[model samples]
Target: MNLGVLKDRIFGTAPTVALIVCAVMATDYLVNIVLLNTPNAYTPVSTLLIALVVAAPLSYWLTSQRQRLERLRDDLSASLDAKQEAIEEADRRRGEAEEAERLYRLLSDNLTDHVALWSPKGERVYSSPSIQRITGYTLDEFMALPPQAMVSEADFARVQKLIRGLTPGGPPATADYECTRKDGTLIWLESAYSLLGDGSGILLVTSRDITERKQLELDIAKALELAETASAAKSDFLANMTHELRTPLTAIIGFAEVLRRSRGLSQTAARQVGHILDASNTLLSVVNDVLDFSRLEAGGLELDPAPFDPAAMASSCAALVEERAVAKGLVIKVKASKGLRPMNLDGPRLSQVLLNFLSNAVKFTAHGSITVALSQKVEGDAALLRGAVTDTGIGIAPEHLDNIFDRFSQADAAVSRRFGGTGLGLAISRRIVERMEGQIGVDSVEGRGSTFWFEVRGPLAELAAPEEEAAPLLDGEGGVRLLLVEDNAVNRELIKTMLEPFGVDVETANDGVAGVEAMRQGHFDLVLMDVQMPVMDGLTATREIRAMEGARGAATPIVAMTANVLPEQIANCLAAGMDDHLGKPINPTKLLETVARWSGRTHTA
Candidate 1:
């Protein structure tokens, strides 16, 4: 407490009390001198009375005054103490505020990030020294310019809009924009903003340069574009190569089958023929796997769904691998559930999937039985069909089962060597089943056996009648004329030889130009048209033939023969007015069936 004022006031009272006591002493001395001059008798009585009256009253007055002075001093000291405490508290708070401001400047001035404060009216109030480092401008230089000097014209409107949208004490907002540095170079910036208010409200902006990040993003985009282009180029190269490859494989397999069935061969020679047939078939599977995987990866193949007998589908696919199973000393069986029904499905693709499972079973099993079963349950007239191919062969290991459906993956490298395969059959089957909206999986015990299964949920519908196979025609059936239009000499000769056994008249045209000319002069039951040729392509020829309606034009059936098996390619063929299509490496059975289907000529070609 501050006692200076109260102490001074108390000391002044002490002097006044001393003066009052002196006045009383002076009066007593004067009265004693007067008594000496007057009569001695009067002096004793008058002096005694004077002493009682003056001394008593004067003492009482002095005591009362002293007490009042003491009380006044106490009150003044309390008031002084309260005023002193207020002054000290104010000084401490000011020191703390100054220290806080010093610390804030210390951190922000050293930052790499740009920091700035603006008044509520959008005028710059404060800018950290870091702004000079980022923009190459001195503090005075920047402060001398207009508020919008550093802002980009392109982003000017957006910046104003964002600032105007901010609310006091609301969550911070972030923005990215372009700005000009002092050197006139444009740079990108991402900034976080908040409206700050500490009595005086202001806006705070913290920004970081993002020019490097933007450039990196651009570089990545360009690289991805180039990669996509390369991927597409690879797909095209593989597609063209596959077409060329299939052409020769068709001839190899076709001739081998004919040779294997030759008349009067010795047993040893027949066995040698069997080996050639088996090897050719194996090569064909490998080629098919590579091509199919390519198509699936490119998403060029699509499922064609239709109503097919579930039981018949399973039986037919099982039949494909039955001979191989029997040769391996394995028994094969087919089973259908009691209430199995025809379901809408991609018949050819489903059969291909089932064939993959059954063939794998046959190849792996040696002495045990292979069973193919189709179980079904009805759901409101639609049915859920589950097809399973179980083989009593060496089972897959537990660890390998997880990745079994991955492309080009096998149980192990040794298993791949022991079991000769391209390792793509299961992968292809999985893709086919998944694209059909079905699920496929496997269950097995090591050293026991394995069961591969698939389930398809679809509605029951009327199954189309099975297509009749191409049978050798008798002479009495009347000769049906066929115009075979192909560009390759080898293919022409092979087709002619393949069709010789059937009692049909066959004529050849070198290309579409010749085929069109030939068709005008001849009445043909069917025209086997190839897509690519010299002079004119098959699509143009077919359209041109349709244009001619005189002798053998619109009424004659035209079937496309080519190795372009993509659905889009087939669609293009049909869009060009061809009635049907057949992909190569042509199955002899399919070739004959296709011929019989359209031409009504039961010739095995």
Candidate 2:
């Protein structure tokens, strides 16, 4: 409303007004002055006024419409950009989902284990392509069959119970089931069932074929059974053969011992009897070696630990070989560490090992000394006892040392022929050491000498009380009343002759049946029962005698005198109520001691 604002507004539209005026003047000139020859009706002012009226309204409307159109175009472009960005994001998400689907199919289709998905109602929802390979059925065919159709009748109930116990989010259940294929062939399947953890009550199952593994297990079981049978048969054969062999050796050695004790005999006859005794003893040693090796091989040589003096055992073994050493003009000595205490060890078995070492040393050494050394050391609540037999003569070669402890192996064929051994001594010794959880080896140089050594660990044990000296085998008042039950006539006679000299009143029985009748009819201080007899075996007769003496009569002591000396056979005799066991090829001293100990009286007059 001010003068300056009015002037500015009026001048701003002056150019539009001037241009319109010029256009109006030009039109008037063309129409009236040139063609009609008429004079202009208005001046420049009037034309200018006419032009301003039209230009002002038109410029105002056009400026307002241009701003509104620009704002509309900007809004449309912004909306289009946002839509394009949203479209791009959607495409990327779609690609990711499609790739994941492809991977899922790739793994499920290629797996060897059959996979299945089931709904809560037990309806099949999906099956992997591996179903055909596992069950010989296409996915569609498998889905059509009931779940029980594929499972064998024997396993279907178990499978149902497992499925019924499944819970969402619980641990998977696994079991082996026998299933039938489409062709009705039976196969084993180790299957796992897991309930889906999504709370949808869906089930997932996986299974793998195990038919070949099952068959392998069955074959292994059969092989083990056959091995056990063969082992038992070998044991029986060995027992029988030992009985047959020792039955004769008993008569040979027993009669020889009797002859050697005869009051009047020439030097030639006495020397000949000595030879027979030596030969028989050597054969007995070989038989013992064989039986021991068999026991070791069968994993049945258990250790019986008791308190024993290692040094005394070593000295005893050396003494047993003293005559042989002296005959060869070889000096022998026992070197025992002073103050070596008693230890819990298998004394008999340890003695066997020591004897084997000393025997070998005396056999191989020609003119040098043999020393048996025993030492002991303490190690943290346990003691290590070591026994070494060192000899100076022919030694083992280096290569032979590696396999010298192997069963039935010798230094060489020449050594075996010259030394005359069955090559089982060192092997048996090695096994004995191993069973004691100990070590055994030899230090030797081909011809200079050999030293055999063994180290065993055991706890310190209390020494047992000394035993009383055995009484003489004759009583002044009355002789021992003993029944000799033996099937072999020569063996019976040999035993009778051996005992009669000491005043034993021997009652003879041909078999176990007669022995049992003899026990029922007469009172004998002891009975010497031989196994493998006719009519009845020793074990059966002993059992009958024990049963008959139930709460009514005195239980007579019966000793098993047979070559059936295997540990099991000894156990059977004890189980049948025998008081003691005396293996065949019996020693006179052992027989005398056994009778005296059980009779509780001397027989010497």
Candidate 3:
């Protein structure tokens, strides 16, 4: 391809051809001269004839040699041109490869992930500049030592073993190990490696520092364990306290019921009995809230969505708190939007939220009015039904506003002491509201009133025909049979007393063994089975009952009554054939509702 080579090829061929022509000419000349000398003919004609012969052949040969040399030079030129093109192509490819390497190096230096190549002898041959960023080590520092020196001493042998087992054509290998930094701090890394065979004494390695990712995983694991531990402790406490508290609660409610049913009771005594019942009910609410909040915080609460009359639900919630408001001489009002439709909502959870707001309002307000308003608001393409609970209660300070919905957070510590609460009501309410894809917030001014509101979307049917109200079913007469399987005697009595007013005929079992026995002998409409009972738990009993043959096989619905109210716990119960789940310190309304729904009867108080 060089011009010098082309010139050399051309000139070398010319000289060879010229030399051959000269040799042929000289030979002809010598032969003529020798012949003339031998014949004694030194005449000018002979000399002229010989000179002519030599000149014709020599000129012809020289001309022919020159043409051949030119042909050879042309062929050589074509070959040189091809070689030049090939050389240029090779140069272009080399430049491209160099550029690619430059870009690769740039990326490797800037990337956060660590990159390095290890030799088959377990030495680091090349490590990117990112080593400084990831491990506080310069490239020189890393290159000065074996790759294993950066690995934790505990993992060095394992890493060596892994390297030794690698084969050139084998599948890629991966490992997670801790590497020591320059400061002696260890960082977790996830490494993926493949062998690159170049007949060179080196292997390619790539690793990523996964310290944050690994820490997150560990945190999650620890959180789950902590949750489980707290759940167990709360469950045990609830079990023991439910038993202890229910004993007194049973006596109080039972005595009041007996007094109400008795003849010739004094007016003062009757009023006192009513007060006792009301106080007991309030205490029961507090207990239920504590248990419910614990379960909700522990991620045990769940929503059961169903179609219900939106107006009716709102009216009922307002009515439940209306008597309490009236007793305090406070004005209470409810406004239902026209043409309100049926909605799919978790009635119990929604009611809980409403009741908590009402209770808080009643506790804080000494005068003025409380209003619960329901109306439809149009946002974008969707219709949202907004429900607001506005109250003339002591307003929250601006500084405390943001934390009002946090668990155990109150406007002031005095609020907890004055208004007895677990400080979990708003937190639970917020969780329920958010879970339903709704929003909850408060509007308040200090020394004025506070308005707590929440909004949830309702079905279009209810939105269109708002006047319709679902009539409350008449209470069923005759005693309803209930089988209560609980280990604690006090809990058993409390449940029995609460149900007795609805004419519930109760049967009890101390544990799963007795519960199974009771089930075989009696035909009860419902079974409240407590989990974590001695001699077998509720889940096992439910399974056994489900496995029964004939009419007794999984017929009667079993509702789980346990302190373990986590989502997974509920799923486990259901999987074991439990029809429903209820947390401890169970709400009487919830129990009645579950009974009414499952027993195909209405409950009245």
Candidate 4:
């Protein structure tokens, strides 16, 4: 296909042809000059024949040999070109390989995780420079050291076992180990193990330091344990303090009630008695508020929901504060919506919230009326009950409204001193409403009025038939024998005074031990056991009495009359063979009702 080759082939025979012609001319001239010594005596045909015979063979031989040489030259030139290309290709491949090695070294030297390559025969063939940083050993030194010298005997054995079990194409395995650095500091290491491919049983291991993370985990665990211990201690302290506080309150309120009900007192004395009762009740309220707030703070406040009329509950709450409001010469109006069917809700807690609102209204208002409005509407399957206490009171400033429901916070120190309160009622109310999945807020204007409101949702429920109020002991019945187990002398006396008016025969025990003995010696209609006493507590005493009774004797109704009023404490009382729980400051009315209900009779003179 090359034109130069074609041109060479066409002109290649020209030299041979010219040489043949020259030879023919020379031979013709020699024959003419030698044979007849005349240039005219030569014969053209014969001479030409002779020259052609010799020159044709020579030309054919020379041309064939020259063509063969040309073919060899072309082949040699092609081979040189191919050889040059091979050399360039080899250089290119070598440069690429050098660059790849440089990149590999860059990554291996800079990485934080230590990398090591091990051959099939348990030899560390290569180690990254980071091995010095991770384990305090140079790469060469790390590779030189025996495996057993680098790790503990147990770890060496475990790693060897793992390596023996590895497959070339299987997933990598990971583990954590406690290791010691060259400086002898203990540290935790999380390591990943993998086997290389290509039928060579090589292993690759990568490891990083997790010492800080491990220490953090340990610190968190210790902190949690300490917090739990502190919480438990606080709960125990609050329980004891509550008992101490309520025991005295029971005596104070009980005697005050007895005195207030007595006949033939002078007007001044009656008024003083009333003041004492009011102060005692106020103190009791503060104590209760503190305890309630504490329970809420500790996430221990639980709602006990039951079916109760929302309207009736609102009216009852209003009535509770009615006396205080009327004494302040403030009119109270309850605009509870009619036909608000009973709903399943925590009636007592809800009432507590409403009472807080009304009490605040009465305390803050001077001459204006307090109105309690209750309304209900159906939303989906739930009935939303909204209760609001609106009053024309000395309204709170905008700044104070934001934090009015904060615990122990009031609208400035002046307001706290002007209106004596623990500042816990609104906070406790807020927590209660929130626990029931409700929202609470206030709308107020300075020196005009304030409205505190809450909205909660519950399902409509069938009204439980009204419970017959537990009647007091009636006259003309058999003597109802009872035992009062209390450690405090005043509380025992107060309880006896509360029950004896109903014609009941009351016996006394100083402690649970004495109470148990009394139960063993005689039969009683009921036992009022007080918790937290010397020798034994009421729970243990009740258990002892039950054990003495066994299966054949009738079960005496044992009611827990203690200052331990927490829900769990009540549950404990029930679990310990007590039939009921009566929390103190003892309500004289409820005390008589419990006795009458349990004893079922009163003594006749």
Q: Which candidate tops TM-score?
A: 4
Kindly list the per-residue Cα lDDT of model 1 for residues 70-96, writing each as its tens digit: 878998898889889888888888888
TM-scores for candidates 1 onward, in order: 0.66, 0.81, 0.59, 0.84
Query: For residues 1-605, what per-residue lDDT tens digits would candidate 3 score against the true structure?
Result: 48975565565455555555466555555665675454343344555565566655565556557767888999999999999999999999999999999999889879887777876666677788988888887889778876567776768777667777888756678889888889999889888777876666467777888999999999999999998898788877865676566546655665566566667788888888889878887776766677677767666667897666657777898888888898889988888889766666776788889888888888788888998888876554445877778888889999999999998888998877887667778998999898888999999998898999998874443333455422332154635688999887867877776777776787999999999888888788778998878898888888877666234323787888775654666789989888888765566667777776666322220
Show where candidate 1 strays beyond 4 Å: 1-83, 117-126, 132-188, 192-205, 219-223, 254-278, 294-308, 325-331, 341-350, 365-369, 376-386, 390-419, 430-487, 492-560, 567-581, 592-605
lDDT of 4 by residue, 308-395 (tens): 9888898899888999999999999999777787889999999999999998899899997999999999866679999999999999
lDDT of 3 at 11: 56
- After superposition, candidate 2 runs with Cα above 4 Å error: 1-86, 263-266, 378-382, 469-478, 600-605
lDDT of 2 at 391: 96
Task: Give the clashing pairs for model 4.
Answer: none
Error of 4 at 551 (Å): 4.4
lDDT of 2: 0.87
Give me the runs in candidate 3 sitting further than 4 Å from their true place.
1-173, 176-193, 197-265, 295-308, 343-347, 379-381, 397-402, 436-438, 456-508, 521-532, 550-572, 580-605
| TM-score of model 2 vs. true structure | 0.81
| lDDT to native, each model | 0.80, 0.87, 0.76, 0.87
The lDDT of model 1 is 0.80
Higher lDDT: candidate 2 or 3?
2
